[model samples]
Structure formats: structure tokens, C-alpha cells
Target: MILLLLLLLPAPALSAPGRTRATIPGDVPVVVEANHLLRKGEGTLVASGAVLVTRGNDTLRAHQAWYDPRSGELRAEGGETEARVMARVDEGEGPLAIEAGQVTRLGSGRLRASGAVHLTRGQDTLQAHEAEYDPASGEVQAWGGESRARVTARLAGETPLTVEAGRVTRVAAGVVRAFEGVVVTSDEETLRAEQAEYDPQGGELTATGAVTLEAPQGRVQGERVVYNLRTRVIAGGEVAAAVPAPDPEADVTYHLRGQSIRGAWKGEPGSGLPQEIVLERGRFTTCESPRPHFSVDAREIVLRPGQRVVGKGVGVSLFGTRLLTLPRIAVDLSGEKDAPGLFPRLSLGQPDTVGLRSDWRGTLPLGGAASGYAVLSARHLFRIGAGIDRFGSVPFGLRAGYKEEASSRFVSGLTLTVLPAFTFYLPAAWSPDGPLQVGLERMPPSARLYSGDIEGERWAPGRRYRLIASGCAGRFSEHPTEVTANRLSFSGALEVRPFGVLPRVQVGGALRGRVGYYSTGTRYGVVSPELSLYWEPSRRDRLRLDWRHQIARGTTPFFFDRIDAERSLVLEWRNRTPRRALALKAELDADNGGLYAWEIGYSRRLECLQPGIVLSQRGGDFGIGFTLEIPGLSTGF
Candidate 1:
């Protein structure tokens, strides 16, 4: 039985230790053992029992190793300790070594390692849970369940730099490829990604798939990110980051989803270079308010500190609600909260005893350096109809002025105003007295007037002292007529405050002179002057005293020389409770002479109520009135 004999016969004698079984044309020997053979013609070799092969500096070892001479590849299989191999050909003092439990060489200088592959070249070391390495091209790939690898290199200063990854591969001398939950941390920052590549020679790193960068300035999140360490530049896609400001009040958090984001370092220590951020197509939202108070969407946007932003196809919203949409929008980065001022107000109300009234006022900017501005306002009142009688009137007017700011003073443009009025009054026999008629008759029936005025004030450059001067002239009509009576008025005031004073001391005087000539042959002249002194010892206490004298003379029996004089003193005190939950104020007024009058009132305010309450007594006409007001609902006349 020839087959039995072939199986039982001893294998051909393998080459002895340190012996050559086959030699190449250049004296390059191929070695094998008793159970191993190198068949160049058959393109295969088999080795067993701690097999060892050498070619110059290249060495291979394994319990069992195989080679295909036709393909010029080698493989080893056995316990990793025995499967280790070193490959080099007089390149240097040391050779590159590859060790794994099982190694397969697939020609083309490529080797795949499974079960704890480790690569080491001099002081450089790479350990992968598993890997594939090509010595000829310096390409290595490692991946497996929960795979990870670490690489370390000693720099010129003997400082060791290390990199760790879940999966790693070397593509070239300075480039390494990594994937599947990768993280790279260097001396300056840390980066995480689903995939990434690093090149130490180029000083560049790129990442994708949920990439995130963490640095001292901020944290950046994006889909893709690339960073250049040498230039200190970082570029990203669909990035979002948090930037904090130096001022606590000026700090703002922004959300930006854009085409890309880039940052560079200024080279100066601790100085983050000003960033130039471009959003090709993106939007921004702020985290401030009852809702997101501000938001803008644009086709393109650029951001730089202290620079205005101009956006196209812009949409802006406040409090989470769209407020405006524009083809273009620009915003100043350094503008004050209320710098560009425009205020308009409208109100309607009915005082318990005064009937119904409405008022409107608004301010407009005139656009100039002189602080030119205009004000337009109007008011209407409808007296409650009683006993089949109704009375109502409307008054409207406009005033424009220019203001200039000087060293320590402000001057106002001369202003002119005209107001026409209409009214109805029943004879004294109609109604002796009623709540509605008590204070209504004091209003003029009808009037037309014109006036010119100049007002100027100077506030001490660094102190609380002020001086004011004002004057005006106008005409009035008791009834509609082609010609109307005229009036002249003037006033002056001065305020002084000593150092460490809580309130200023104010002294002022006013003068009014009127000369009227009617087309109906009626003439009258009147002059009135008032002197006043006011002192506020503190925010809660005040005192005022005034004296007025009036002289009226008429040219006809229908009129007469009427002389009236009055002197009054007033005192007020206000205080807030220690708890700050309640406030109280009291006032006393006394007048003597032709218009002798005395009044005392007190008011208490509570935070929960509309405002507060007042109780007053004046001579024999004492009464109590309460008022509740909301900004847009109250009317004052």
C-alpha cells in the first residue's frame, strides 16, 4: 500500500538551522526546515515549528509560516507571541515590526493583522485592537468591535505627543486616517468626530459626521470641520457656537446654522483675533425675552465686531412673533437701546365728573445735526348730555422745534402754536350747580391764538445748577372774528444746588401783559406778574411760596379796572415705607388776598392698585376723588 507508505515515510530533510535551502541570483537565500519547502516552480512554501526566515534586516517568525514565491508575499499563523515579525532591508539600525495572533500577507506588500496587532518603529508605536499594514507604502488600517489605537512620537524637546482613536490607519508619512467615533486631542484643543484624518507635517486636521471642536474661546458643533494648527485657523460647516461678551449686559447668545464658520488666532497672547464670519445661507436667533426676542434670516450675512450688518431677504421677529419683513435690513452693532427715539401715544377716558375725552401725541425725527424734531397733538372732550342738552368740542395743534447741544447748554427753536375752541353754555338759570358743570364753565368759549417763544437752559458743566428763560406772544378770540386780541408773556427761572445737596433750590418769576382791540370797538389791557420760590430739602419734602398781582383796565362801561392779588404757600411731604410696599404723600396749600383759599390733601399708593387715592378739603368745597389709570387708557386735560 503505496499511500500508507507515503504517509508514514519521514518528510524530506528540512534545511538545518542557519542553512540556506535555496539561493537567489544575488546570494539572497530562502530558508526552510524539515517540514517546510520552498518550491519556486510551484509558487508555494510551507514551514513549521518555530519557523524563522531572514533577508538582510527583514525577519519573519511563526509556529507556522507560508510564502508564495510567485507573489513575493509572506504570512504567519500561531500564538501572537510566536507570530511576531520584523521587516526591514538595511534601511536603518532598527526594523519595522508587526505582531498579531494571526497575520495574512495578500501580496503587494500588504499585510492584514487580526487579534491585537501592534506596530512599532523605533520610538514610534501604534497599537490597534486589530489592523492592516503595508510596509512598502506605510499604510495601516485597524478596525474591529470597540476598536481603538494609540500613537506616540517623541519631539525635539523629548516631549512625547500622543493621539488616540477608535479606528486608525496611516495613508502616508504625515497623514493618518481614522473613522467611527474618533477623537483627537492635542496640546491646544480636543476634537471629536465620526470620521477624521490628521497630518502632522501639514499641521492640518479634518473631520466629518457630527464633528465638534472644544477650545478656550468657545465650543463649535457642525457636520464637517477642518483645522490648521500652524495658521491657527478653523473652518466648519453648519456650525453653532457660543460667544460671550466682556460686558455682562452686552453679552448675547447666538445660534447660527450657516454654510461655514472660520476662526483664526491673532498671535498676541490671550487676544482672540477678531473673527470674520460669513453665513452664505443662514439664520440667527437670540436667547433673550419672554420668548426669543430677536431673530433674523438672510440669504447672506457677515459679522464683525463693531461693524454694521447688512442682510438681504431679511425677516426679523420679536417675542417669537414676526414683526417685519424686508428685502434688506441693516443694524448697527453699537447702537444704544433707545437711541433712535420715536414715541406715539393715544388715550381715551371719561373722568367721573368731566365726561369723555381723547388725546393723541407723537414725535417725529427731522433728520439733521440740529436735533430737529416735530410734535403733533390733538384733544377732544364731550360733555355728558343732560336734560336734552349736549356740548362737545375738539382742539388740535402742531409744534416743530430744533434743539442744539452745546458745551453745557441747550437752546430750543422758536415755536408758534394756534388753538381754536368751541363751547356751549346755558344761562346761569339753566342749572344752578351740578357735578358736570362745576369746573366746565372756566374754559373759554372759543379762541384763536398765535405765539412765538424761545427757551434756553444751561446746566452747570459738572454741577446741578440750571438757569432758564422763556417768553411767548399770542392773540385770543372770545368768539369767531376777522380780528382778535393779542397777548405777551415772559418768564425766567434759576435753580441752584450746593454740593452734597439732595434737591435744588429754585427761584422764578413770570410776567404776562395783554392788549386787546376788537373790530366791534372794544379795548382792554391787563398785566400780571408772579414771583415764586421753591425748595426741595430732600426727595420726599418740598415747599413752595408764590405771590401774584393783577391789574385790568377797560375803556368802556362794559368793562372796568379790576384789581386782584393773591399770595399762596404750599408744603408737601412723601415717603416710602421700610418694607417698600406702600407710599404716602401729603400736601397743604394756602392762598390769601382776593382769592383766599386753603387746601389739604393726602394720597396713599399701593403697588397692586391702578395708582392711589387722594382726599382733599378746600374751603367749604371739600370733596374726595379717586382715579385709576392705565397708560393707553387714561386721558388728561
Candidate 2:
């Protein structure tokens, strides 16, 4: 509602063709101009042909206007063939303008505008079918739904705001209210509520009664929500939220129910993504079922959206049954598919090999690009040991530490990239059994003739070939014998995909050969040639088969590097959907003419959690294990 204080002072009427002016007595004189002004019946006046009324810095233009001196009533309208009536007022920062089909000032000091009414003040604007303003009460009300035109208001800034509803009212300066299916959109967030009010002075919008806010990052619903437009902060009560897939490439959505929640976003100024959020007395789950299979409850939870979530006084539940409780728990939003099994990581070991073994592993950052990892394991009953290794990479240089499980030897190696496709490594090992002895383990230089992504299933027509060759000379302390053994070895592999077309179904082959000579008067040479066929039936499915034959003459002194099978056939299949995946692999021994080893794995994804199982069999040994992992925080059980 706009207040137009029109106080007219009577002036001599004119019927000439030229323009005439009538003035109003005021601090800022009000002037009325018309091409023709005529005295109507009694004290009534009529102004026609380009009627213009100006008061101070404000001006109104219309085709015709009628005024009654006694009633102090005025009416203005656009001609049948002319544009709508328009008015503009300067308000310091910018101009305020209004346009309507017809406008009237009632005897009771009420202003009404009908038919395609539009009002704009500075960066804010409103549009409706009709509007009414009462100057005495400083209230303006707009209605639109009846004519199939909903009232819309726009508040523009860096993060622009637009609201549309059935009705809108301005009760005071900088305060606006809306009702009935009100929707407010600010940048990427869209909010809907039964009723809402906004205060431009404070940059606050309060929504009540079934409030819901949705954005690209997630969805939030509550009974009431107060959002700070400028700061992009949200505070709400009794909220339920669904954070779908941390990003667009994910398939999971985490559902959270909380008594109260507060969130703040950090990104592009108007991205509407909450990077930090706090929820009180809440429970969350990745399960989509109404009755969740698993959930975590916590007294307080803090979330760093798309990164991790931390909870205090946490309880984990499965099928409405409490499984465990802890003082605190934190999980990453990115989940891993395959990880070591539950607490005290257990692997089903063959009795003839290592029997049952349990291991605990941890990693620590050693600063810069270096990290240290440790593994403690207990095998059978007599063997218990811990091994630590530090690995780092600087540009093209590599540093690594490793442990030989069988002989309890610690090995450290440094590799330097001599060229883009060539590297040299020097390795040394120290034995901790009996008397400590350190010796040079090996020196290896490797070169890759060519490297390519031949299995990417894309049509890049060319003959793709990859070849890598390396040679090593080393002195190792062989167990059970005190004598030192000197060894020289060479290994190389050459793979070539001769055809570039038919990328979805490609054929490849590789020739791999190794030769070793020991000062202990033992020599071994082996060569393996393999033919592999790969097929990708669709984006979600892949199949590959490999037939390999090895020609062997002698055995190596090291048991760990000895070849167990000479001829084998391997087949692998992989299938994936948005939320589920399956993988299977099998190998057959051609010499024994029977199945050698096989494995099957399946997993389902839910947000940041992926729990899976693997079943495998080799020879007479069978094994099964469960795995859970979080990729973002890199933790698993």
C-alpha cells in the first residue's frame, strides 16, 4: 500500500486545448496538468488527454482523471486504446513505481488499484491482480488467486529471493507477510510453508506450519524454521532431514531424525549446501525401508557434509535391537567396497599354511607426503609379531619399507624415476632373528616400453602394446641355512592388443618370462604366454576370460615367489547397478583338469556405508568373510 496524500487547492478551470496547471497547497507543491480541463456538474472537475499529476518527486500519468472537490475523491483510468495508468516515486536509493489498469481514491481515504497491478520499490517488487492501500493504517494488501494470477514478490540481491502465494500483505516498512501455499525461493533453496513472514531490515525469514526446505545437497522439514538470508544459516525445531548421496555421483541418501538442528553452509555464496550441521538427540540410517535394518542413535551429532559425521554417546542398533554402545563414533561419507573384516581382523587361513591368524592394523601420517602403517598379527599359537612400514612419494621418487613375514626381515627400498618410463630401485633388508645382520637385498632397474588404457572399452583405433622389463641382483640370508645366497634375476612382460575396433569386445595376449640364477648352484627359468578375451555387454556388466600356460624347468629357493600352478584358465564376471553389485571369478587347473580356485562377492550400497561378504575356495580349503568400510575417513571394521 502506498500513501498518496493528495490535498488539492481549487484553481480556475480551463477548457483550452493547451495544458493548464492546478496546484495543491503543501510544503512540496502538488501540480496537476492536463491538455483540457472542464467543469462538470456542480463542484466536479474532469481532466482529459494526457492527465499528469506531480507531487514533489513523485508523478502519476493517466489518460483521464475525475475529481470531486466536496468528497475529495479522485479516479484515474487508462483510455480504451491507451496503455495502463502509471506512477513513479523517488525513494533516495532508487525509484518506486506502480502500474495498473485502473486506480481510484475513495472518499474514506482508501486507494485501490485493479487489473494487472504491479508495484516496485528499489530492488523489491510485487505483482498481483488487484491491490488496496490504506494510508491511515499504513497497510497494503494484494490479492490475485481469484483471477488465476498468484501474488508474487521479488527481493533481489546477490542471493536473489522470490516468493509467490495466494495473498500478500505489507503491514509496516520492510515487513512483508504471505499466506496460503507460500513458496519462497532463495538461490538454490526452495522453501514451502503454510505461512511465512520476512523482515528485510534484519535479513530474516521465518516459516511456520509444516515448513520444508529443499536444495541440491539435501532436504529439511520441520514444524518451524528460521533462516538468515544474508548468512545462509538455518535453525529449526523438530526436524527430519534426508541427505541424499553426498554428491551427484552417489546412490545413497542418509535419513536423519532429530529433535533440533542448526546448520551453516560454506561454498559459493548462494550454493545452499550446508558444510557444517549439528543435530541434537537424533538417529540416522542409510536404509530406505520404513523399518530400518540398521541405525545409529546419538545424543549429539555434528556433520561435515560430504566429508564425515561425528557422534557423541552413540548407540548402534540392528532390527530394533541394540548391538553396541560407545562414547563417540565418527564415519566418513565416502564408503569403501572391500575392506578387512570386523574387530581383530580375522582371515580364514588354511590349517596347513598359517592356521588361524588375527591382525590389527593402523596408519599414521608421518608428515608431508609420507605415512606410516603398522600391522600386528598372531598366527597359530607360537608366532606373534608386529611390522611397521613408512611409504612416501615425492614427484617421481618413491620410498618404501616392507617386512618379510616368513623370515622376519625388515626391508627398505628407494626408487628413483630415471625417465618418464624408467625407474631404478635399491633395496636392503635386516634380519632380527638370532644375531642382527643387514645386507643389500636387491637392485632393480625397470622400463616400460609403452603404457596405455587398452581395457577402457572406448574406440580409439590403434595397435596398443605395453611392455615392462626389470632385472635384479641380490644377496639374501636363506632360513635353515647359515650360508648367504647370491641371486640374479630378470623378469619381463609384453602385452599387445592388436585390434583397436570392437573395443567393447577386445582380444589381447601377453608373454611373461622370468629367469633366476643362484650362487648356491641352483637355476630356474619359466615362461608364461596368455591369451585374454574381454567383453563389456553394457555399462554395468563386464566379462573376461584368460587362458595361460607356463613352461617351467626348475624351482626358486624362495618359497613365497615359487609358482604353484603351471597351466590355468580364469574367468571373471562383474555386474553393477546404482545400489547393488556382484562379482565372480573362477580358475581351473589345466594340468589337473579340474577347478583350482573360485571366489564370489556381493554388496549393496546405502549412502556412506557398504557392507559386503566374500566366499572363496582354493583346492581343499574354503573361506568366508564380511567386510565394512568408510572411504572418506578411511576406517573400517
Best by lDDT: 2
For candidate 2, what is the lDDT?
A: 0.62
Regions of model 1 farther than 4 Å from truth: 1-53, 60-73, 76-108, 121-125, 145-166, 199-202, 246-252, 263-272, 288-291, 305-314, 324-637
- Each prediction's TM-score versus the true structure: 0.44, 0.62
Worst 10 residues of 2 by lDDT: 445-454
Query: Taking the candidates one at a time, how many backbone clashes does each contain?
Result: 2, 1
Q: Which of the numbered candidates is closest to the native, going by highest TM-score?
A: 2
lDDT string for model 2 (1-637, tens) is 3322122222323435668777755455556788877776785778878788766666677898887767766788888976677766454334556688888867775668888888876556788898877656666788884767898888765557888988888764657798988999987889999999987777889999999989886888999988887776778889988776665544567677789988774444667654677889998776656777777789998877665677889897766788769777666464442222122233333321223333322333573221112233233233332223333321121212122133111111111111112122223222334432322222111011111111212212332554444454555443333334666666666556534348688788878887878877888888889898889989889899999898887866654335547888999998866656688999887887777678898877655556666677765556565545322332232
Cα RMSD for predicted model 2: 11.2
Per-residue error (Å), model 1, residue 470? 24
> What lDDT is reached at residue 162 by model 2?
87
Cα RMSDs of all predictions?
Answer: 19.4, 11.2
Instruction: Give candidate 2's TM-score.
Output: 0.62
Question: After TM-score superposition, what is the CA distance of residue 138 in candidate 1 from its true location, in Å?
Answer: 3.9
